[model samples]
Target chain A: DTAVSQTPKYLVTQMGNDKSIKCEQNLGHDTMYWYKQDSKKFLKIMFSYNNKELIINETVPNRFSPKSPDKAHLNLHINSLELGDSAVYFCASSRGVRSYEQYFGPGTRLTVT
Target chain B: AQSVTQPDIHITVSEGASLELRCNYSYGATPYLFWYVQSPGQGLQLLLKYFSGDTLVQGIKGFEAEFKRSQSSFNLRKPSVHWSDAAEYFCAVGPGSDMRFGAGTRLTVKP
Candidate 1:
């Protein structure tokens, strides 16, 4: 069984188009995270939710918003996608808020044309 | 601000040869160190993590890392390289609540 999973393995949309990526974790973890990996392969943490509560909100723009319906799910919604938004988005989860080890999903490749 | 640095952008090694990937970090306090691997079209997988202990941590896939406090370095080493092990490796550092990652090093194993 996949520990952390994200839907829409590949997403393609035009500029200004809004979209959402769904993520689910069966590991029963308390903390979930959203990360962005750019073309240069630099992974950056975007947002993190602990027990459905916003724990870490990086300096990401307001166009990006993360919603956690529960501790097992955290979805990312983009208001208006831009050309620069082309990258791989990864979903991860940890056993606890303070745990350093994280299990990541297969990642969703978002392409904004 | 906590940050990670992976000096080598790419590394090439021969199969059955030893390999080492360097990682350095700058943090104010005792930082949590981690090494993760990413295969083609796959998400990152945790190889090993150093929170607090003997500083030598063993991980899956025959990977291990040693954390040095004075040097502020955590390096990943393997006794022998396999062709399947050729992939991108990332070094990360966690300070308190936030975690930051390095740019990653791409390894190519030649047979």
Candidate 2:
């Protein structure tokens, strides 16, 4: 079984459209994270949630929102997606905020036309 | 600001050749270093991590990294690389609860 899983490995839509990517971790971890990889393969943290509570939030635009319904699930929803929003989004989980090991799921590549 | 630097953007070597990937990090406190491998269409897999103690850390798939606190460098090396080792490698430094990743170095292995 996959330690972390993501729905819709690829997402394609037009600019100004809204979309969502779902992620789940079977590792029973308490901390989850979201990262965005740009075209240059530069990965950066967008948000971190611990036990369904938001802990870290980067300078990401308000158009991008992260929702964690539970500790195992964290979803990314983009409103009025722009061309610059196209990138690979990754979901990761760790045993705790202080834990060293982090498990990442297969990324979801989002394309905005 | 905490940051991670990967010196080489791309590296090429023949199969069975020695491989080394350079990484440098800037953090205010003790640097928690990690190396991750990203294969095509797959998630990032941790190769190794250095929290403290021995500077030399061995990782899965026959990979190893040495952390140098003086130079602020954590370099990943392999005695002999396999064709399957061709992928993107990332160096990350964790400060507090947030981890920062480098731009990544793409490895090309020749047969």
- Worst lDDT run of 10 residues, candidate 1 chain A, spans A94-103
Compared with the true structure, what per-residue lDDT tens digits does model 1 show for residues B1-111? 899999999999999999999999998888889999999999998899999979899999999999999999999999999999999999998842468899999999999
How high is the lDDT of residue B50 in model 2?
Answer: 91
Interface RMSD of each: 1.8, 1.6
Docking class of 1: medium
Error of 2 at B20 (Å): 0.6
lDDT of 2 by residue, A1-113 (tens): 89999988999999999999999999999999999999888998999999999999999999999999999999999999999999999999988887366889999999999
lDDT of 1 by residue, A15-75 (tens): 9999999999999888899999999999999998989999899989899999999989999
Q: Each prediction's Cα lDDT score?
A: 0.93, 0.93
TM-scores of the candidates in the order shown: 0.97, 0.98
Candidate 1 chain B weakest ten by summed lDDT: B91-100
